[model samples]
Target: MYDYDQVTAFLGKWGPFQRLIFFLLSASIIPNGFNGLSAVFLAGTPEHRCRVPASANLSSEWLNNSIPLEERDGRQVLSRCRRYRLEALAHFSATNLEPGRDVNLSQVEQEKCLDGWEYSREPYLSTIVSEWDLVCDNDWKSPLTTSLFFVGVLFGSFISGQLSDKFGRKNVLFLTMGIQTGFGFLQIFSTSWEMFSILFLIVGMGQISNYVAAFVLGTEILGKSIRIVYCTLGVCIFYAFGYMLLPLCAYFIREWRMLLLALTVPGLLYIPLWWFIPESPRWLLAQGRVQEAEDIIRKAAEKNHVTAPDVIFDPIKVQDLNSQEQQTYSILDLVRTRNIRSITIMCVILWMVISIGYFGLSLDTPNLHGNVYINCFLSAVIEVPAYTISWLLLQYLPRRYSMAAVLFLGGCVLLFIQLVPTYLSVVSITLMMIGKFGITSSFSMVYVYTAELYPTVVRNMGVGASSMASRFGSILSPYFVYLGAYDRFLPYILMGSLTVLTGILTLFLPESYGAPLPDTIEQMLRVKGIKYRSASKSQRRLKYGEENSVILKNTSL
Candidate 1:
């Protein structure tokens, strides 16, 4: 097994730099929050109106004759009749004015007369049938475009994760950022529905890589003590920050395309990631490139004004043997083990439930009765407190209990939304938003918990696969929104039941609060709670020697 003390000592020596990198990687995900609002801009069709100029010779008799006296009262009625007659004359003159002909109007003068009356009305001309109409244009085009973007993300995660492992995290980060920036800029110039769909897909492809790299790189560089917090809560904070920024964009940028362009601008700043971000040393060692890993470590030590230790690199010492011994982790491996199998099954069900209900609720937000802007704003605002609740509960309660409570509460809230009368729709939405907050928190917790359950080698692969599965829920969300044809509550009923079922599954998962992170399949399979099953007598002695060496090294430093 790898020496935890040595790793801890190394982390303590270099923790500050890791923390800084974590913050930057977290900041990188902020732009994705605005994606929820992208449809609003893509479908906007604002109307413009111009009025005709007033004419002095307009007849009042015709307009007065048009108005019925029973609908009129005294001077107020007479004044309205006279004003209407003059406005009618202006409308006629503006439409029919002859330039340089019988009329004395020049082309310029005629145009001015057309602009003469007051500006009348300017309204958005787009169709508004359901709540989805206000949220996004309910055309086949916008939904298809949005779905294509998620599809890109599904593929991009797998591609990016592998590339990061092969090349290095920093390079992938820089490359993905550059690609995302380019695609984001292209999305602004998309004129037709087809063009926008294609651009968004490209954008999603670029964007997915960055997030996967950021999460992996952040966790790899940090100490185990703070790894979960830095990766999970840290990532969640950035996501929430992105959510908060969406409303600000809505308020400032009225034009949809302009708003998208504005959102894309910040991503360009991430280009400098090439120079600042470094490759993960742990990853290098795992690939048996010890010299390169040592060099990187030496450079980091130099930057921190600390001298490099005189030590020989050993592949056997560095490799996470527990992970290597497993060789292959199949679906059967997940279930064949007792505690592990139960955990895997629970995780899968929870992933499905949270994915469906969380996204289902979010997708339906536009249909909720209220100003779309205010409703979105409130929903985002509530997430801050939701995060706080997550932080608090995670510290006090066992992971499963906290997850179950939150999910059950979320389900109850969804049921409440369905049962509430239409007149009390606002109250129902408010409760639904609270439920959404709980579910989102639960979703974040699951990501953290999954990392702790498995050993290191399969960590990225397992998380990536599970995340991709959860994304299926996101993929189905737009279709559910479109399914308002049958009944608006149909999606809600399905999503709510799934969440409750997930909560029940949470009971099956074992508590992992103080358990050592399983390094190998043998350690994972120790159902009798036996200790050190994988290590031989000689290996145990070597482990003690390494622990002593790590203690001596730390003290000398």
Candidate 2:
């Protein structure tokens, strides 16, 4: 049977048709970047204090002084969750008050704020925190919202692949895009935190579903040479650029509702793209819609100014199509075989580490040592170079080596952060960015490596399972950030340790570089040579050393 890549070579390779699809699909990812991390700014808690009532008739000095000081981490600070019982204090004055002689200030009764809280308006004019008093006792709600979003992503990852395969990639792509855009807009009018969180969950499902559909579609439609570029530079880079735009958007649009609205409005730009992009030809062929697939191939050839054959997939025998349709697979298949089970487990762990480290650092931007806007922008910007470098390494190194190297390096940088002096914040932040760059590069490599590891029958299932693990890790990321209250370096310490462990585990997976994608459980476990289908003797492959020896032998002759 002819592989999709071989058939695609005739249609076009890195041509105008392919370029348009790549850009349009990648562009749709920008809104996802914004909505995914919007929680950082939208739910950020500003410096706040318990609200004091004016009915107490206390002087300006007395009113400001009413909130008593408490010792925390060796520093005196005003109480945020509690205030003095003002009825008795209203009668007292500076003349009558003395720390020890007249009244012991520490003996004053304190109670939780009866009237709401006052928030600082410096970084944000409005946020979920200020709008609903989600501070102090309610602070837990902020992280919970972010976690709920990823819960939706977990469900979406499990379902989107099956839906895209049953229907068509293009239809699923558009449907998810609509879901993302519609729910995002709905969030602006939310009457309560519960309503906003529910909408955000639906939007989260749409976001991941949209991204997965685009990724699978691009991989199927583009030529082999261009597929890696599409995944890394085209998809990941565009997503990173959108992430960079987020903080800048938030910096100007200080109101949380308007900021969210601004991020969502970009989804409208993708609507016109529906006319320009076509369904994946490979998927069409799989569904036995040969005419529709052929038409798309011909259109691609015409746009690329190349002459295409009368029937691009003419070599596919009837038996081959039947074989594909007859073959059945399930989640059980992933673990039913020893080799596949090992591969699936390792990929899951690696993906989980990447998610926690990547998002743990990303969502913890406010805690970093710099202006939050600049820190976030820099964090997003760093991924661009990391992804580019990943593409370059993919061309030169084995998949396992490149992935493990980056993961290990990222972990080291994260761990080393603990040694940096607190006053030398610039050094610390730079190291954090470097650590991010490493993990980001590994993230790009993992997607490509995962696809190549699994056989065609279970490829979608394998990637989807790995993605679900990633979403699970992302769900845990907010809690990781929340740990900073005990100690600022705690999140980094935990993320770093796990990343290092995953990096080591990544080394155990068989190298996919210069190797065939196994089509059966037997082939996956036993076959270690060749770069194509190994079911036939003609497809037998020579090792790298053997190929080198062959060249030397020919030269000597």
Candidate 3:
């Protein structure tokens, strides 16, 4: 409804109905955090070496020497793929009775694990890497698994909007939840990497679909004042809760399958939400299901102990009061003017860089040189403060400089991690966490700042294009994390370099602290602080039919 306030004014805000939608929708977002990052533990590669069977009858010295050591991080460690030729170890030369002490290991011929491999069980009982033997030359497969999921996410974003309008938001929301849960559980039974990857892709699709659906639904149902809270603290914070729970679950259940199973079963609890969470009354009204919309609104009014007007919305008035010819805008519109073009380019780069940094830091948890569980938990827990601080900054600070400062802070600390001694892993992890905090805050702030930068004609299109750029960033994120296999600091260095570059670019953007939203490119480029200087608050209020678009900026990760 263009005039939804007319209805919500009687329905009242913060009442039982709004409360239910707020908490239930927020709770529904919890699984996404775990689902998104579960790959960190599920695909974790444990320390492994060639498995020398007892049937070889090699002596203790020979058995110990069977697996060769390689230099990594300035220290020798057991080779994951290469080993001393077992044939030579089984039949030692008469001149050299003991290996390593007498014979130089460098002279020994090395070969791939001929007998298979044995993995260390100190941290993980099993992971997909161990199960599928996705190590050695195939180590890239581990990160590829995470990237494929985001590929599914990219496809999901393409279709979710059309599907949401085709089917009701509530319908698609629960349907996606079911898909996430069902596929998540089914993933444990995957016999090969191919099967798990396929299921994971579909689950990724559902994960994002529901998140978008829930976000849109909340915007439609919640009153104007509460929608912002629902967008920021409600959905985002609960996602952190689920993220926090993931490490705790993985800690107790070291086996990847068990951890995966434990993380997915909670979806069943949200199944009952179908009854408690109603369809968006506004969607029903738009669909011309006015009776249905009225029914939901009436229920809400009664639930809130408020009186509803005898006739909430007249059908004739709805059709005649605010009807206008719809205007269409495409990606081309974003670059139609000089200001819009510059803004679009900058916003896309910023959004993509933020996605890469955030997901890169998250997937790097296992490689943080400490207890993976604790590191993962710390990574998840920090988001709460990151979000709170972001909310505070957006309220008081100028949008342009605050975003640049956080990105600079995050990037600089990540680069500093390279300066610290590798042995001082605590310092490295601490710096990495600070980087996550900055990226996370930037991630939240970018949506608000970028949306304001665009004219209304292409506002949604501007954000959509930027968000699509972000999906590509996320798809490439695991590979950035994969760089850690070569050097522990490599991923951070790459992300930091890009992040710092993006931060520098942020300085070019015009400040939008209190500027009224521009409806056209000329308006957007107009001199600051003209008529809008004083009327900014009233002029910036969300207009009818526009509040629903806020969901377009929902942070899916």
Task: State TM-scores per candidate.
Answer: 0.72, 0.89, 0.92
lDDT: which is higher, 1 or 3?
A: 3
On the 0 to 100 scale, the lDDT of residue 88 in model 1 is: 41
Against the reference, the lDDT scores of all candidates come to 0.64, 0.85, 0.88
Q: Write the per-residue lDDT of candidate 1 for residues 1-557, one digit (tens) a residue.
A: 57533643543534556566777778877876666435543443222222323234433433222222212211222111112233443454446643235333211211122222222122222311121222222345545555677777777876997899898887887788777778878877765566767877877877778778887887877667667676657777787788778767766665555677787788877777656677887887777777887776666665555655675345567765524665666555656556555556566667767877766666566666666566766767776677777877777778778888988888778777777877786787878887888788898788767766665656655565568777676666666665653476766677777788888777656566667777765565232232334668999999999999999999999
TM-score-sorted candidate list, best first: 3, 2, 1
lDDT at 283, model 1: 80
**Minimal lDDT window, size 10, model 1:** 73-82
- The CA lDDT at 543 in model 1 is 96
Residue pairs clashing in model 2 are: none
User: For residues 258-333, could you state the per-residue lDDT of candidate 2 as single tens digits?
Assistant: 9988988888888888889899887887787878888888888899999987667763562376456556788999
Better of 2 and 3 by lDDT: 3
Model 2 lDDT, residue 189, Cα: 97
Better of 1 and 2 by TM-score: 2
Worst 10 residues of 2 by lDDT: 525-534
Clashes of each: 2, 0, 0
**Candidate 3 off by > 4 Å:** 93-96, 321-323, 526-557
